[model samples]
Every structure is written in structure tokens, then in C-alpha cells.
Target chain A: MNTINQYYAGLDMGSVSIKAVIISNQKITGWALIPSGGNYKTAATTVMTQALAAAKIRREDLCGIGVTGLGAQSTPFDARPMSDISCQARGCHVFFPSARTLIDIGGQFTKTAKITDKGKIADFLMSEKCATGSGRFLQVISRILQVPIEEIGELSLTSQHPIKFSTNCAVFAESETISRIAEGAKPADILAGVHKAMASKVNMLLKRIKLAPDVVLTGGGGEDAGLAKAIGQIIGHPILVPPNPRLTAAFGAACLTMETTSG
Target chain B: MDTQSQVKTTAVKGTDTAREVRPMVKDIYKAAHEARENGKKVAYMMVASHYDEILRAMDIVPLPTENYAGLCAAKRDMDRFLLRAEADGYSQVLCSYARIGLGFDSLRKELGHIPEGSPDGGMPLPDMMIGSSAICDPRFKWYQATSRYLEAPTFSIDVVAPPPQADLNRVRDYYINYQKEQFQGLIEFCEKQTHTKMDKEKLWEAIRLGDKAWQLWYDIDRLRVAIPSPMPSQDHFSIMVAGHYYTGTQKAVDFYQKLYDEVKYKADNHIGVIKDEKYRILYGGGLPPWHTLWIFNYFESFGAVFAIENVYRGFDPVQVPSHVTDPVDFLAWRTWLRATAYHEKARQNSGNPTVEKLLGIIKDYAIDGVMFHACRSCRATTVGQTHIKTELGKYCDLPMMQLVSDMVDLRDYSEAQWKAQIGAFIDALEARTDQE
Candidate 1:
């Protein structure tokens, strides 16, 4: 049960996945990610159980829990729900204390938050009425190209000549990709094109909030090396990615849980 | 069923002003239908202009395009009409209100009758259309396009923006003269179309009635500054439709008077719009999504009430001096003032009028947080919103969040996503309050 020290947990029930993190003595002890699927409650329970086992801590030792993301409110947990914007800022601040800008590309939406040196969110911009620069877009293209989502990034990096995608819409882009494939375009080229489009859209959001130096990237889309490189190319600067980029929000939630419990 | 009876039967619990406002809106639609059947002239006016009084004075029925668009959106019936307009080569990027109105207009023209499933048997075709250069460019094009299709005479009032440093009083005469000449020209145009001369006495009466109604509306809104805000902005949204289209008539004056009485009653009894109100919020930008107004209920569940909305705040006409006696001059003053009041007020407060106005509202209403709708179709309102949030951060320490959705299109809205964002915002507000 590891009763020698107190433990705190965070659950981020995002649209595409359920993420959980366990922290002890201000350090991340364990984290887990599982597809959210249709039933978020079940997914959250499963992920939290896996996270606790990985941390080798009993549920009774947890002092508090914090939740975030789209499915945060509905999670069946004794946790305080927090906005992803604030949690993302907190999570990134832990990794890069100088980070003044944070970009989170999740499943259904992409958000850019401007953070203060004190770890507070100064302002934010989010994708609206479209999913052009979100993880869902990348997943859709992966299915069409008959490639695993994780491998699309490595494959894209190998392209010698990338095709240009004219549309930013996910549905329309799928048709465009299919047609390009029919015309004998290489898979690497198509994937690279998708990455470029995603980067351009994300760059627009960043520009709106005026990207500050020491920008941090997180969320599911942050795992894609091709997209990260594309964003860096578009902005002409390096971006910071946390060690556990996809689990940052959950980690932030754990931090919040610890703060509130200690207080 | 008659509107009054329908309102009494279907009104939601605890919203008296909304119940009263619904019947008045229905009556406007009914009048439009009757005017068409009786062969009387009807004119379409954009929401940006303050010309409803002039039309009503000449015995012309005024049909506001935005009001009809709102009705369609509230009923969730905009899909068919919007698709119809898009099919006819109208770009999808055009405002949804314009798309719906143009689609309905085209369908009515083709069918030679009110199309099936039209909202309230469709709006009557206008014999004339009036637009202004005050708000957005698309409005000008919208009126022009519809005027061409209906073969109706269209008159556009050119409203020049006041200079940043210009004294409104010193430059007032120039604008008044220019607007007066245009008003005279419009009267002459209407006289020729209807074969009737404008009666000076009737024009004066309409102006006085409209001015009285507006003053009362302003007073009613002031009551909202009370703790636990007596009414939600949704009620104000419904009532403003009457203020937009029927302010020149006794019906609208009476509506406002009754609304004022009810709101005052709530204030006296300390009856908050949301029971046990925990938080008061200011809706800082973009228009309310008419399709899912139950979004208010979502906030209500958390004991939060939107004390005021930016659109509703801007809807009030600027106060005209009591000394302006000439009806045309008064109308001119109102037209200019209504067009530029929000911006002028912002400038008076120093930097970024929108941001200044919101900060002022937060203090006046004791706002706990701010929420921006970030409507997808409205560029004018949605633009600079993030900047406004940033600017507001410099002035006030309140929590703010932006919810991205379309103004009228249901397809662009995801209830789950909206709920998630709203829930998160509420949590932020609570966390801040606890820290304080």
C-alpha cells in the first residue's frame, strides 16, 4: 500500500483516450493510457486501476484526485474537475518552467494556451467548428493509408517529395488522399502532406495568441514527430515536448490534487 | 392557436418576460401574413438600421430579416432553407441568416406561394428593402441580392464612422443633415411606391413612441445590475426582437412597460433568475446560439446566470437629447448613435472599447467570470476576441473562457463538447472563488 508517503491521482477522460497519472512526493510515479472507446466510465476505471498497479500504491492511500478533459465531469471518481486549459498550463510548467506558450492537440479539438511565469493561463485559442488540426484527422489519414497511427510520423519523415493537400477539412482530405493514392502517390508523401496541413492550421492558432518563446507541446498529437517537426518548421523555432507529452494533462491533474489536498 | 394563448400554455416555468415577449414576436409574423393577404406593402429592414419607426409611420409593415433567421434557428429548421440557398450557388461562407432568408425568398418565388414547412407560414415578400453600412458588408449585399430577386426598391443609408478624436457634438450637425436628406428621399420613394404622402403628425407620434419604449428598455436592463440579477440575458434576447422591429408601435411600448414592471417586481422580491444563484457571468462576445438556448439551463444547473450579453448591451439605442424636436433629426441622431455607441463608449474608457465595456460590466454586475461564444460565422464579433481576453486580463483578475460554436447552425455545435467546456469553466470559477 506504500503507506509511508501520501499519493495523489489524476484522471483525464479525453474524447479519444482515458489517461491516468499517479504522483508521490511531487514526482510522477506511474501513468497509463487506454482508448476511451464508447463508455468513458469503464475506460476511466480500467486506466486508473492500471495506473495504481504500476505505481504499486493501494487506492486507499490516495489523498485526493483531480480530473480534466472533455469527459472529465462524467468520470465516476471522487475528484475535482478542472479545465484542460489550466491543467495543461500546470503540466507544461512542471516540465518547462520558462514555457510561455502551450499547444495541446487532442482528439476532437486543438487548443493553444498562453502561460505566465507563475504557471497561470493568461489567454487561449481553440479550434472551432472544425477538426482540421486534431488527432482525429491524423487517425483518419492513417486508416486510409493502411498504416498504423504511430508509424505515420516515421513514414512521413522518409518522404522525398510531399504532395500538397488543398483542403483542411478531415472528410474532404480523406477523399483527396484516396485520389492521390489512386494516382500512384507514395504513402510517405501523402502522410507528409497531412502533417503539413495540420501544422499550418496549428500555426494559425499559435499566431493568434502570439507564440511566446519556450513553447511547450502536449496532448495525443504531440506524440507525432512529423507533426512536431512540421510545426517547428512553420514557426521557424524549436518547441518543447515533455517526457510524457500525452499524459501531461493527467499529470497536471495529479499536481492539482496534491495542491488542494495539502492546503 | 393565437399567440397569446400559445404563450400562456407553453411558457417555461419562471420566465415571465420571455412568455410575454413570445406572443409579441408571433404577432409580428401574424401581421406580416395579414399584410400580404390584404395587399398592403411590407418592407424588409436589416437589424443594423433604426428605420422601423419611419416604415410604421407610413403604414408599412416592417419585416426584420434577422428576426426571421432567429426564429428558424430557434425552431431548428434552418437546415433545409440553408441547403436550398447553398444549392443555388450562394457561398457557404455567407452569414447563415442571409443564407436562410435568401433560400426562403428564392423558394417562395419559385413556388409562387409559401413553401411547405416555412416558419409560421413564411415571411411576406417585401415591396422595399432597407439596409445600412453601419455593421457588416454582407448585410448590404444580402439586402441587394434579395431586392433584385423580388424586384423591390432598395435604399441603403450610408453611415460614416466617427473619427477617433472627433467631437460627436461638433460633428453632429454634418451627420444629421446628411441623414435628414436621405430620410426625405426615402419618404419620397415610399410615397411614390404606395401612392400616399407621408403625414408629418404620424411620423412624430411614431418617433415619440419608439423613443419612450427604448428608454423603458434601458431602464429595465439597468435593473439587472442588482445582486442575483433579476433576469437572465435570454429573456432580454427575446424581448429585444420586439424592440428591433416593433418599437414604433403601441404594442411594443406596452410590452416594454409590462416587462419593466415584472423585472422590477423580481428585484423588489429579491428573486434571482436562477434559484440560489452562485455565480453571475457576462457573455462578452458573439451572438447567442439560438438553436440550443437550453445552454442557459446548463449554466443554471451550476447555479450560474448570464447577467448580460454583449449583443444585448449593444442593442440599446444611445440616449438622444430631449431638445431635438424635429422627427427626421431625431431619427438621424438615433441612427448615428446606435451605429457607433459601443465603440465610442469603449474609446471613452481608454483602450479597446470591447475590453473596456466588458470590464465595466463585470464591476457593475459583480460578474464572477466571462464567457465568449466565439461564433464561427460572425467574423466581426469573433475577431479580436482572444485579444480582448488578453487585454481584459491586464485590467481585471476574473476568469474567462471561450466556447467555439456557430451562431445558428446546429451541425456545427456538439452538445457534448459544449457541456465539457462549460463544466470545466464552472470548475475554474469555483476554484478561483475558493482560493479567494
Candidate 2:
């Protein structure tokens, strides 16, 4: 008897990060991430190679490739691409089956999705197109604080009484963050405060989706402790942070294999 | 000189831009009288320039389709649009812009009357017309209903598109046919007024001038893709008027090249869409329509770049399925399918089949945000803005913002609301910037 492995791939070509996930039978087998640079093609191929390596599977052993992300349709292999919401929901459901609400805080956009009892998207919402709470926004702010992003998550945990910044515009926010530094505010506190603001921005969208219980926060932004705690506190619920929040979309992309590939 | 300074009406006299505009304004004033004198209600029929030809052929004084005057009455008018939708049992797929417009339009602004005589450059009501070119599906139906209510001749141009199976050559033929029909209707209307056979040379001149204007506009746009986003979106309206109205004349072409050269100069100085350290944003909003294209370009100097617009490229999908014998219908439909995006235009704005297809462009172009223009006059676009924004977030996880505007009513603008909304929106974007 001969059998073929059914593989699904999800590629999230976000403004800040390019993530890819390989899944089989709705299980996330492996994942990879790379910063989106001038040429996304290189970024995409790098992540794909890493994910394939992590999964210990050859690229040719796949039945179908399902891509989902901001740049899903642009996936190189002509693999079918689905919406980010659909892929995120599928990805989040793999871990916490009851996670009906998903709030993906990526680099450039904050997306809130309400999932069905069957792990499908029932409704969704997003913040305005500006970069305040997204990865793009964070990159600019991080430069002002001079803190490495990987360290932002750990540093935010040490803050006590974070300082709040006024003005929502990214340019102005950057200025405000600089002023806080000038005033000798603790870098950790300022970072926490900024994460609080992001949480507030996300809360607005969560309200649109009715803030159902058991929220799953994913995306590159989800890796920040300040954001995770702030979001959890704002919504008055315990938010679920996956092992690697940034990998959720890509992980979900891999798991999105139904023989038909139709919604 | 920058096109802004060159086209400033206050600066130049005897220039064709001023000349054409002066006469059109005077004629509108006269025609307003002509209609009232003929015992016909002189309605100020404002419409997107995309629908100007059809409206012109219908002998109506059209308003420049633009952002609303300032958002007061228009916002309240949403109730009327909602009522209309409720009565019609609209599907959930409809966006909020339409619901609001229909609700707003249905309201009795002042006791069953258009309040006789408020033509101080305000959007005048039409006696028997409602512009519905179905730029999206909902507006098509809304205008169709409005026409029925006014008992006006509401001619819907179904923008019959070519299939993906059709060859590119066939598509070019389709373009020729659609262009002919639109021009034919325009010519017939102009002929009835001027009593001339549209003088084929004049039609050819208009076409040539229009194409040149487009090229010049594209050249100018190339500069917009620079750093600090280049020019802000606020100036897009001025650009549109210069491009839209003046595009018909040689003055526009000259003005455009002059503007382009200036932009090229600034770009040479390193002051454009590609700043060394600014983030570029490709913004996707509904068609700038008339006076609001500048609003879309406002993000230029703020580390943003709008590389393309899905709405502006309705012609991107222009492919002819068969030979069109009636050049007049062809031209009208060509204009229809590309712009004013009502029924015949088949524009892929909100609440239309093309909305999903448009996502492909947004992705392909790597746009930073999707700005959906929720126009009050455009039932097709306005009703489902919320849904379109939400769906984009859901499907593509794309960030979207909406400017609740009118197709032409400039009075509906609200500097305060716009600023606040933009502030909030920008805040969200900033927070997402991967802050340390």
C-alpha cells in the first residue's frame, strides 16, 4: 500500500515579519520566521527552508500547500492562499479548542477575530491603518528606547508604575517616548506604558467583536509581556499566549489542509 | 513651478484652465436659470467626474463629486438610507456607507422640501436624477431607487466586462467600444445643445487630451511615491480638479508637465516618496472621486507612500469580450466600468463583486493600509464600509481606515472629526511600530 503525506503551508508576509508553518492533518509540525526586508522573496524562501528543516520533511512530500497571511496569495509556489483571519483562527484552535476570539497584533495591523464553535471565523474587526500598536509602530518606538525587541518582553515585566504617553500619531508618539526618556523615566516603565496604550488600541477592536471569553493573542507583537499583560488586564480576562505567539499564523497556515481547500 | 502654483486660478488669466472653468461656472449659473425659466426645477446634480459625461448628456448641472461640505446634515441623513435598506431587506453583506447614505438621504432635512434656493456652491438636488453608476453594487441600487422616486430617467450602464478567458487584443477592442459609446452619449448631448455633429476632430481632441492628462498625472504621481510620502493627502483635491476638469484642455497637459518637472527637481534634491529613513505605505482607498484624492495622498510626507489605488485602476481589468458596434454605448460604458463605479462601471469598490478581487491588488501592491471612502451619495460604497474594513481585517488581516465623505458635497467635510479619526488611527499604527 502506498500513502502520501497531506501537507498544508501558511505564509504570513507581514510588514515586519515573514512567517511560514508546515502542518499535517491539522497539526502544526514545524514553523519559522524572518524579518521582512527589501526583497520579500528572499525572506519567504528563508522561512520556508527553515520550516522544512524543522519539520524533518522533504519539500516534495507535500500533498498541497495552503498559504495565508498579508502576502499569502503572493506565496511563490502558486499554493492556494486563504485570508489571515481564516488561517489565524485555524491556527489558534489547534491549541486551545475553546479560543473563540483571536486578537492578532502584528507589525502594521491589529486584527480581532471571533471564531465559531467549529474553529471557523464568525466575525472580526481591526484597528485603523496607522502603525501605533502594530509591529511597524513598535520598531520605531523600540529605536527611541534603545531596547532590543527580544528583550522588550522580559524588560517590561520589571516595570512598576509605567508612564503613559500622549498623542496617538506614530511621529508624535515617538516624540513623547523621547521626552519621557529626557525626563528620566524608567525605560522599562515607559515600555510598559506604551504596551498599555497598545492594549487600549486593541481593546477598542475587541469591543467590536464583543470581547468573547478565552481570547487568543497571536502575531509578532504578542511576544511582548507588556502587551500580553496589558491586553489581559484591559479585557478583564486571562489572555492565552501561545509558546511562540509570532508563529501562530504560520503554524495555522500549515494546519489548514482540508481536501477541498475551500471555505 | 510646481503644478500647485502654476494652476492657481488667482495667478493666471486667459489660461485655458480658468477659461474653461469660468464658462462652465457661468453656464451652470445660466442653466440653473434656464431650467427654472423652463418651469423645470433647476437641480444642482453633483456627481463624481466619472459620471459627469452621462449626467452632462442628460442635461443636468452636475456638482463636482467630492468630499462632503462638513459632515453635519450628511451624517444625520444616514437614517434615511437605513430606512431604505430596512424596507428593501438588504443582505448582511452590505457595508455601512450605503446604510448610512440611504438613511441620511431618506431624512426630511426640512419638512419634505429641498429648501428652495441654497445654491451657494452647495450640492444642489436634481429634479429627476440620482447618480448611480454602481461603482459598487449597493449604490447602483440606491441611485436606481432614487431615480424612481424622482420619476427621473435613471439609465443604468451595466459595465459588462470581458472574461478572463478573453484575449488582451479583444480587451483593447472592448475599450474602444466602451469609450465610443460614452463619447457618443456626450456628443449627442453636446450636439443637441450646440446643434453640431460632435465634430469628430473635437472627440479625437478630447480623447487625446484626456490620455495626455492621464500620462502627466502618472508622471506627477511617480513623485508622490517618495519619502515623507512626498505630498500630503490634503492636496489631492486640487490635483484632481486640475487633472479631471483641465485634462480636457492643452492647458492641463502643460500644467502637468510643468508640475512633473518641479517634482522631478525636488526628487533630485532628495525630497520625495523614498526618504532614506521613512516607512513607505501603499494606501488603498475608494476612488478619490473628485475633490478628495488629495486626502488619500496626505500621508506622503509622513513616512508613507501610496504606490497604487485599486479603485483608480478599474481599467486594469478592462478587456473586451466581443466587438461593440455602438461606439457611443461603448464610450459611455467604458467611462461607466472604470470610474463613477455605479452599475455599468462595475467598479470594484465596497459591496461589489470586485471588492474581493481588489484585495489581490492591495496584496500585490504591498499597501500599508486600505482606506475605504465611505461616500454619502454613493449608496454602493457607503453602506458596507464597516463590513469591508472588517472583512479585510479578517481575510487579509490588513489595517483599514474609512473617511465618511460625499461623492461631491464639499460642505460635509469636518476638519475636527477627520483630525481626531486620523489621530486615533495614527496612534494605532504607531503602537504597532515594534516599540522597544
Candidate 3:
């Protein structure tokens, strides 16, 4: 537990993707995101190796490791399991020090947390056991619309009349999207509607907790410009999206290692 | 994946006295079964019906169905009944307690006896039923539905409290008078069903016993105001069985008296439910998830002890006076006062009654945060919890979170999700405390 130029690694073993980030001298040096698939331990190791390789550091060189997300418990890593809410708050705050509110849209769940000035979570609100407001819902729609996940944001932005989805349930929304397709609706319009539905769901969660200034969106869902735009429009405020938003929690996990090591 | 099978029951008792509750409840059911075998009349009653004393006066075995449902849920045996009720055309959205009761009755009729593995020897078929809609309409209606299956005469009483904004001085007499009339009707119904005259002396004795037990219970509950709470809310949920289900009986009185002494001794010694008490939480209103009572211990792992719960606040509102010699009048007055006590206190504070009461509890208990379990099946508990949480946020600087799940429905809950939320909440509470 050296407090010098010690390296720290954080792995976020999320439901949809395993994310890893390496930090040195209080800065993120390398990051990796890979599909979690079915084996969390393998995913954790693979992502960690890639992130370590990118950072040009050996595994033994790391001073500490922090793990987070749904699969953190089972991951084969000698790491401290931190709540994703805490990690997300710390990571978002490091990128934007003014950030007081953070909305992390992970694969399966969306969480909204209030951050203190010192990069600590003050409170958090999680989405119920539903996928309509999550990245999985977006992924489901991507497969149905035959659109690449990466292309969804740009494609959805071009739509003028978004198909109005009737339900906020992920399963029901899938059928609704199919019905819209059968009705000869454009894919971009349907994707836009999906964004609106997702944004509306996130807005409901945001409304439940106290909304503060400098709202930052992170996690896989943060990568979608269409969703960010829709959420921004709904909340009547622009949201900050840092570079590689999905790595924020992993980065925060890495940053927390600094504190753990220094202590 | 059957979430039902995934649920594991825990035996961690919050207090030694609380350990007596399940056995006491089981013995009540056993007594009811023996009562039926011995050709004695038994009455199915709701927990908050306020008529257990009358039934006790008449020597009618009072089987509290809601308490039984809670026990079933706690034992993780409720899904069989719940699923049966769902199969019998009852909506899953209906009150889970009702579903369990109706399902139990339906299954008993089908099998010619209690279901194979009913917890505490399943509730005996009642000869009579006394139902009240004081808390919610479904409570009485649940009994009425059960009557259709069991053929037991069901008497439903309406005991609506005046609105929180109502001027009690103007409405108190009317409500008490109405409630007294309802009790009279209930007594006549019971007397007719049992073929016995109303026993005035016995009723008085029952009332006196109930009052004594309640006072002792109140003293026991107030001991939680001590820092490093001697008893956690999980223990209260168990220990409340006597006051809730067996009130007016000597057993209930003796139980409370013993519990009061035990808790008082602990409070004096500054003994806590957990050794290192860090965060003191106010269980801000809702029926707890009975199946996952282990969640209480999980919170304990984070050095959090639920100091008090407002859900089953059994003490008589001291501010609301009751000075009636007549038993019926006293019950009516007590019922009305208990219902409006929070609102009456809130009017003086000029805020939402539940919110005001919670803020006071937070202060009195030195609470660090609040956890509101929003049970989906029970609207009476779940509806305004978020509003209270929001109001608490506006009024106090404390960490609060709403946990949404059903008290009895396994399908509506996820332990992983709940534990995650609890972890985050405790972390936030610690961080906030550290900063302060």
C-alpha cells in the first residue's frame, strides 16, 4: 500500500458489460469495456488484462483494486466491492467538480445519485426492477430496428415525428416497437420514440429525488446522444457527458483505491 | 426461476422477548383449533379491528387473520395460498393477506383439513367473523369474501377517522357516537352468533386488561427513544403480536409487562440490539416485508439499527384524553383518538402529520436516516411514503430512501436490489455523518 506513484485498477462488473480502468497519479491511464456474457469471472479478468495492457502496467504493480456493479460479488478479484452509486458519484465529480447530481444508466438499471462537494454520494435513487429506462431496452430496440447500437443516437436524431410508444414496460415496448414497424414507421422515428420513452422514465426517477445543479449522465446509456438530448429537453437543462461515459464508475472505483491505499 | 423457492427464512430474533411472539401466535392458532375440537365458537378478526376485547369477553377464540398472514409470510409459506387465490380468479393486485386467508379457506374446503404445512397449525375455521374497515375498505371486504366460502356470519363495521384537517372539537362527538353504535351492532351480532348475552362485567375486565397491557407496551416502545436503542424495529414487529392480536388477555398483559421490564433494564444499561450502533433509522411508515426480515440484520451489518417504526404505534395518544366509564364509549374514543393523534399533533406543528411525527421521531431518537418500505400490496402504508420522504428531505438534513416491495408477495421483491439500495443508503449516511 505505497502512497507514491502507485497504480490502482477498478473493475465494474456490470450486468451487460464488464468495465475496467487503470489510474496512476490521480489520473485515468487506461480503460476497457467488454460484454459481460455469461461468465463474470472471465469477463472481469479479460477486461482487467486489456486495461492493464493498455496502461502498460503489470497486474502485480497495482497497489489496490475496487470492484462494483451487479456482478462485483462473484468476480474473482482481490478488490474492495464499492456501491456503483458511490463509484459513479466519485468518478463524475472528478471529471466535473461542479457535479452535484449524477444519473448512471447502466445495462439493466438506471440510478440517480446526489453527490457531495467532496465526491461522496449523499443519496441515490434506483429504477425499479424494470428495463424500459435502461441500456438493455435500447439494445432490444436496436436488434428489432436492425440498427447498430452505435448508430442509434445519430439515426434517432434525424427523426422528425417519433412514434409515440404506449407503454414504458420493456417487454411491452418491444411489441409496441414491432407494431410501429408493422405500421410502416421509420426506424429513426421509432428509435426517437424509444429515446423519449427512456428519457421520460429517467425523468420520473429524477423527479423522485431532489434535482441539483450540474447534472452529469454516465454509464452505457450516457453514450447515447439521443437519450441525453431527450433527457435534457425533459428536465429543461443541459447534461454533462464525459469522455467514455461508461468508464466513469470504473474510474471512480480506481480513484477510491487511492484513498484506500493511502489509508 | 421461482423466486419463492429462492427465499430463505431467517431465525435471527431482535430480542429475547420477541422470540416469545411467534410461539404465542402459534399457541393462539392451536387454541383456536382446540376450541373448534371442543365445540367452542371461534371468531375470525382483523388485527386493528378493536373488537378482540369483546370477543374475549364472550370466550370466543379470536383468530387474527392478518397476523396469521404475516406469520405465513415470515415463514415463507404464503405463496401457496397467494397463488391459489390468484388461480381462484382473485386479482394478484388484491391485498395479499386477503388472498392468503381466502386461499387458506378454499384449500381447507378442498382438502377437508388445514393445508399440509400451515405455520403454527393453520387458523381454524371460525364460527363467526368480526371485520372492520378502519384502516382500509379491503380489510372488512376480505372477511365478507371469506364468509362466502366458510359460511360464517360476517359483521362488517366502518370506522373512518375524520380527515386530518377536520376540526376535532366539532367532529369528535359525532365520530365517537357513530363508532359506539357500530360497536353495539358488533356486540349484538356476536351475542346472536354465540347465543349468549353481552357480558358487561367481562367486557369491563377485558378493557381494563387491554388498557394495562397497552400502557406497558407504550412504556416498552418509548424506551427505544434511548440512544443505542435497546430494541430494534424488527423486534417491535414481533413483540407487537400481543398488543395487536391478543389484547385484553392476561397473556398479552403479562407479556408486555415482562417486555417492558426487559427493555427498561437494557435502556438503563445502554445495551443495544447491535454492539456498535452507528446509524439510528426511523422506519418511516409501511408494512415491512415479512419474508425478508433478514434485511434488518443486513442493516445491522452496516451498524444501522432501526430505532423506531411509526406503523404499529400502539400507545394511546397522551394528548388525546379519554375519560369515559362506559367500556363502549372508551373504546370508541380511544379508536378515534388513536386514528387522529398524529394529525392532531401535526396541526399544532402546521405540517403534514406523518412528516411532523417523523421529524419529531428523528430528533427524539437521534436518528441518522430514515428507511421507508413502500409495500406495494398495502396502499394504506405505501401511498404517502414518498411524500413523507420528500417532506422529510425539505425539513431535515438526513439520508432517506424508499424501498418498494410487497410485504407478502415474493414476486414483487428482489433481495439483491434491496440489499444494494440499503448499502448505498448506509454508505451515504456514513459519508454525511463523517462530513458533519
Error of 1 at B48 (Å): 4.3
Give the least accurate 10-residue stretch of model 1 chain A, judged by summed lDDT: A1-10
Clashes in model 1: which pairs?
B346-B353
Give the DockQ of candidate 1: 0.31
Q: Model 1, B310: alpha-carbon shift in Å?
A: 1.9
- Report the CAPRI category for model 2: incorrect
Q: Worst lDDT window (10 residues) for model 3 chain B?
A: B314-323
Question: Model 2 chain B: which ten-residue window has the lowest total lDDT?
Answer: B6-15
Candidate 1 per-residue lDDT, tens place, B2-24, comes to 23322111213345766766667
> Which residue pairs clash within candidate 3?
none
Query: What is the lDDT for A112 in model 3?
Result: 94
Instruction: Give each prediction's DockQ, rounded to 2 decimals.
Output: 0.31, 0.02, 0.76
Off by over 4 Å in 3: A1-4, B1-7, B314-323
**Compared with the real two-chain complex, what DockQ does model 2 have?**
0.02
lDDT of 2 by residue, A74-153 (tens): 56776765556666777788888989899888876777877765666655565655778577777787888888887886
In candidate 2 the C-alpha lDDT for residue B122 amounts to 28
lDDT of 3: 0.86
* Residue B133 local lDDT, model 1: 65
